[model samples]
Target: MSTPEASAVSDEVTTYIANRIGFIELERPKALNALSTGMIRGMHAALDAWREDPDVLAVVVRSQHPRAFCAGGDIRFLYESFQRGDEAARDTFFIEEYRLNHAIFTYPKPYIALMNGVVMGGGMGISQGAHRTGGLRVVTGSTRIAMPETRIGLFPDVGAGWFLARTPGALGRYLAVTGETIGPADALYAGLADAYIDDTALPALVDTLRSEVFERGVDVVACVERETAAHKVVPTPDTSPLADTRAFIDRHFALPDVAQILASLEAVSGCEEAEWAEQIVGVLRERSPLSMAVSLEVVTRAEGAMADCLRRDLDLTRTSFAHGDVVEGIRARIIDKDNAPRWRFARIEEVRADDVAQMFESPWPAAEHPLADLQG
Candidate 1:
């Protein structure tokens, strides 16, 4: 929306200003703007400055890459750092990353995320929080969003428990375990996206936003919505299996436990939608058992404010780093590319209730917790 700032350009993220709109563009087009530690830290600094700068009336976030706002975090770098025993880098990445996410969630100014393309994992972490917190979240036709952490031996962290718990029906559980992709329409239907703007129209939309005037008493999100309405395209027909299977998903995933959820799926394996049930069953069977178990607990127990979920996730993430299926899953999915992770538990049934309970334990005292400052 804005011209590039002479002083704010960076290798991964660029910041600029035009007509009171501060723009943050993901600059790592090669990595699909996958977030690195430096990128998150830069965002923190930029946001801190913009939040105070009177010239900046609003903020706009998009990516230089036409194909992806952000694919995810730089997981390969995280994997290498973990393998090298550099816990500082890994911990710093998560700590600062989560803090930035919280800042975006609670930011007072109008923060707009033009989610143009592949928004997943850490990408979802940053943008989804903004969306949930009354920010301007616009998705384009190129948008393909998901929380595919189960595939990588991770639960949906980054306050996933908070947002996913709020999705329609059991769709959150269905998405968390299956790693399925959803389009703009589905994203809006599921409340993960606010509006749909076609990718081709973004330049004009950004220009309009750049030149738009803002007043102190006006609602910023509503103002953007009204401006974006002219360019909003009617999304194509909904063919997402998530929508079609909602009844089944809500019915089965309503169960509290993952093992029971599997049993519920198996119970319906002989029904009219037997193939669909079996297919989902196969998906669950393929994911990391420990991740599946912990994810269920996180989603089910996520019943409070966003800060509450993040605090819980902080514990889950730390425990996951110590003893969960992350290393093996990362090895198979990222390091080795084998797609064959030897999980600590062989099956969903093998993942005990106590195993999940262990992951929820706070590693630090409540007063010393990294995310303890976040208030509802």
Candidate 2:
């Protein structure tokens, strides 16, 4: 076998191309490789180089951290940047991050993601885009994925509107409002992952890929599928909490309005699923009312092309920083550890239709839009 050659981009991430494979590893274990703006820039540079390299037939993305592929973006950085009144700081992050997302989503060669541990927020932004492109998404028993952004006063902005909107029934709405975590079995059931292979087999799987001979005509996903099948186990569908809550999620979340969704849950407050209903209602109450309302509207309006949804998200991201609850949410939950946020709206009922509508409008013209270059 040929020896592998690799290059270090930064301490946070590393890149290498060996034997027809391009490997990008997120390397900040202490922070679980939480994406800083520099880390995003590094991955983008690697992808840009590999996109044109004929020698690189496939790309494998994973983290050096054993416990988490990535927890999310560097929220502490975002908070501090916003506080310092650095006008370009937050904008630069989202603009470049979303562009990186579009690049990964539309990359021509096979992009394989070894999603080993906690994947959420920006982590989902990167992984889910690859999953949508027929790329390999290998999950393990250790994999825990969620889009729990509403808890921190932000909507699920990293293409959640595009992909989650298309999930069966109103399950996307349920996930948006409640911020529930799902394991590998539920992830597969939700169409968020391609295969579930145990953590113990990961090294062997990587070795097989590294040593295997490559043919130009071979189907990448099929090749990966065959390799993973040797280690794949049938996860119990009943073990998934999402599976248990399916009927309740679909029925109540199908309501057109947020108020109606709440009313539907409240009406069922005394039924057999009363405890579940109340718990959901309580979660909604604790989250930023503006965030919950805007998230509902964001996902509800996610009806167009993926690029279009991303463009819409850029608008929401900008607006949220200007007038939304990001500061309060981060301050209470992350900084103070108080578990209490004094949101702009005291109650869900206080979030009016116009307030939600304002978030969906674009602040810039089509030509001037930062994401105007997105192809797909």
Candidate 3:
């Protein structure tokens, strides 16, 4: 848990600033920078300190590897706690994680996520929330992002409803349900990424910031341009595989519910994106049936402001874990990787309307709710 040097990260943590640009680099590359409670606490403490510090201006968040900016939250640890029946442990992680998310959303300074690679589920949540709720004003996340939470038996949390509801077209539900990877091109179009710099350019960008050469009206776009010039990944929707993907998504997900949609996809003929539909449909088929249903209910019903949606999300998340896809999916994917998840309900048809109702039933008494103290 060593603290970071000005630009170089330590074994578990790193912190430093040069030219008014600060960075908090996650150093546990082997873990793919998957956030544990310890890591979350470390990041929380670091960002809190930076909030009021004057010398540290714009903060750049990155990691020590190419594989991921962060793969996701440390679900392995959560699964263990989950199996051990450690409610306190689970609550500590989720509560703190959400608190950190809320803080990042409202953080007072410019927070730039150096989303180099392998951003997914929990990774997307943390990075996604940094998009311009506004403090020091320079806030950004990435289309380098992907919220594949549902794929692994989790829902899209961390203001997902907030960001996705605002995303173009019907993409929110498409990504939520299918957990497909959107590259730099789609990332730009989806507003998930602000700038599409090539991954190799990261070191140079860091070096520039570390060199004490920054100026007022410091050209972030120019920096991005210099780095990304050689490898500009432009999104061409006409030529995009996303067009067919989009159509299939709208066709299936646009239906009234998961059951009807799955049935429709199964029966559809001559789908232009047949293979694409089948691939994504397979992902949906692999997902937890009950969790999938709960998510459709949550995302579509998300209303009011981002905060309101998040609060509702907390309830849905808590209830879902108690009775949804998390533990089963975790066992199949991580604990065993057998890919044979014996979901509570074998199929969406088995997920009765009452079952969906029960899934939304909050486990925590109002006073003991996980996010009771959150401002939203």
Candidate 4:
């Protein structure tokens, strides 16, 4: 049997019509909308065309699945790349992925993300980089946002570091370190979403946006905002559940060392949100220590030029792949479902400075910052 995407469209043209908002929906639901190489290249090509097309004013990216907009990078394909040791494939994917994020950040025309379902890792990359981050009229709900990459021995990529790093207080550090799941309230509070609406309203919104045969001056964003307002459910947390978490997050997560942060969390007991702190306590303990260390360090330090973060991330990812944990972590956590990882260090406290510090070191060194092509 062919894949659902193969059955639906060929040459990566997944409904490339330009009625109103140039609409391109990711339809590979069986993979939970995990982005494939084809999907990435396809999106790049479509967006490149739309940027030049006169009639296309905006773009509406959607997926057929109600459960997830995008869970993350297609690990199955990534696993293949890892096994084959395909350097070119790895570099192309990252370059394209980073390019996609940059495009969303700088798209000339108004770009909106209908973050209607589960979005994480790569999902967060695109959604957060939306021209309208925390945009006014998202078509999904609070229940669908999460960033659980740390548990699988991976740091939050797809601009997680960039977006989260800029969030108020230490929430970015907290979310990246813990890989905790948050509802719409927490997601919005952390600036992960703009507005939260139910999935039922999505179809009509898509139709209204797409089917409109109109003058070029139609304000798409305002229309979406007004139309989507009736269903708006801004997550109103009582006390920014993120407050206590962010304080503790900033305190320790900002420490110079990852092991130090782990020890600090282990010792933290009397803080205000002690219960939630303890609750996520087990979560931090279970995540890959190496990933936690790098995520914390890179995110804190990934300032300066925007391109630098992507460049640094590529190095970190390549190094992480070479390290044994991603393979073992995926084996235990995803493929075999073993849930028993013989980590390089089982205990977070046992994770050493050098162990975590090495993830930032690049193999290419000074003359070759894998992303030099960014010099445009």
Candidate 5:
């Protein structure tokens, strides 16, 4: 067996090749592997190097953190940058992050993600793209997943508008607006994960990848499938709570806008699902009204290609920083820990249609857009 020479791609990211498999590991345990600009660049650089390397047949990504695969992006960095009036820094981070997401989405090799623990926000950006490219997304019982951006005054970005839009029925809209956490069963039910294996089996799976021999024309996905199936624990038929509420979720979330959805939920006062409806109402009430409105618009309008959704995200993010409630939301939630965000609109109904329309408007001309070079 050839010993893999591990190299630090960045302070927080490490990459190596063993047994013809490229491995990218997130090492920022303190931050739950929350991505920084440097980390994003490092991961992308490793992928780019491995993309055309004939010796490397597949790639796997995992986190060194025991509690999280990746929690999200470095939002504190963005908040601090905003405080410092360094808009350029914030813009650069999003631009590079989105590019990395696109790279992962379009990678020709089998890109596998070991989604073991907390996977949210930017975490989804890097991992969700695997589904479209014949990649494997492995989840464990401990895995907890959510976009959870609307809670902090941002809509789900980092190409979420694309992937979330494609989830089972109106489940994507439910996730986008509520920002609720779901476990492995719900993740699997929602098409967010490919396989489930015991957390104890993860190390053995990695060992298999390191030790197994791969002849030319080997099926990497099948290799992973074989390893995962060895330790697979089939979930109970009713394990997914999300699946149980699918009809209820679709009924309310399929409405035209946030206000209508809230009204529908509020009107369910004496129904069998009243508690769930009331809980959803409470969640929506706590979120930024403007963010919910913008999120609905983004998810509903997200169509065509991944690049198109990413481009739309970029535009909305710019507008969000400029005139939306993100800064205050961050202040209340992360900075002050107050949990009391004074959103621009007192109610979802007050979010003007014109304001949401302006968010969708691109800051730059189509030819001059930052992601113009990105293709479907």
Candidate 6:
């Protein structure tokens, strides 16, 4: 085996090859490894470079931050871009970010994501692709994952709807509308994470990947499975509240729309899950009504391949920025820290179905769509 030399892929990302494994580390700890346009481009470039490199049999994505694998996209950057009327820059970020997501989804080799902490929004976009690509998504006790875009008046983008929709029963819809934060046990139960390793053991796992030798034609996935299984932490019984509330979630979330879902939750009475339903109702009330409605539609429609979902995500991204409450959401939640957003609709019932339908309509023509090249 040869000693590996690390090289800077960009200011926020680093790439290296060691022991037949390629490693990409997110380096922006100050911002909790938020994905900037540059980071997205750098990651895509690294994957493209290693796609056919025989020496590199697999790729591992991790972060330098102790508190986050990646928080999400650079929302503050997008907020400022919108403030400055830099539509091109704002549009380019989503375009490139979604393309990077597509690359990860379709990567031919093993792509492992060490999801240690704060995997949300754009973070979920990058890491969740491993589940479908025959790769590994390793979570830790510190991992706190959510697609909490609805909280910020934005729908979950970056193919989240696709994966969220595939979760058991109506868990996807419940998560999409309420933007709940779930721990590792729930993540595994929801099919979002593959293994739960103690956070303390992550370094040893990475070291093993970097130093262990393998015979010819050895299975990389199995090698990972063995290493991770050694450190996997079994959850206590009934650890996942998401699992406990599955009946309530499925009953309400499977309704025809967000309005009916909330109404059903409000009507819950004398049941063991009543408290959970009420809490979820309160969460939905705070989120942008339009965003919740749009997200419900997005998750409901995300029934096909990842590529198709990415295409629709791009469309929603464009529409959300252009005509939805995303700008105000970011303004209140991130920029101002005011924690009060004057949403487009004061109540869920006020959100018009036509407005939600308009978001799914692409601004660009079929051939001219930015992600049109992403085929299933």
- Give the candidate order by descending lDDT: 5, 6, 2, 1, 4, 3
TM-score of each: 0.94, 0.95, 0.87, 0.88, 0.97, 0.96
Give the Å shift of residue 325 in candidate 4. 1.8
All predictions: root-mean-square deviation over Cα?
Answer: 2.1, 1.7, 3.8, 4.3, 1.4, 1.6
lDDT of 3 by residue, 173-250 (tens): 777666678766676566676555656567776776666444531343245445555555644533445654666666
Tens digits of per-residue lDDT for model 4 on 191-247?
766666677877787767655544552377766776767775544643455643566
The lowest-lDDT stretch of 10 consecutive residues in candidate 3 is 133-142
The Cα local distance difference test for each model comes to: 0.81, 0.82, 0.68, 0.69, 0.88, 0.87
Ten consecutive residues with minimal summed lDDT in candidate 6? Answer: 230-239
Misplaced by over 4 Å in model 6 are: 215-218, 232-239
Candidate 4: global Cα-lDDT? 0.69
Which candidate model has the greater TM-score, 2 or 4? 2
Tens digits of per-residue lDDT for model 5, 1-376: 5689545566798998888888999999899999999999999999998889888888889986779999999999999998999989999999999999999999888899999889999999989988876878888878889989888899999898787788898999999999999888888888888888888888888887888788632477778888877664346424678888999999999998999999999999777899999889999999999999999888898877889889888988888988899999999999999998998898998888888898888989999999999998
- For model 4, the run of ten residues with the poorest summed lDDT: 1-10
Better of 5 and 6 by lDDT: 5
Query: What TM-score does candidate 5 get on C-alpha atoms?
Result: 0.97
Compared with the true structure, the alpha-carbon lDDT of candidate 5 equals 0.88
| Candidate 3 TM-score, true structure as reference | 0.87
**Worst lDDT window (10 residues) for model 5?**
230-239
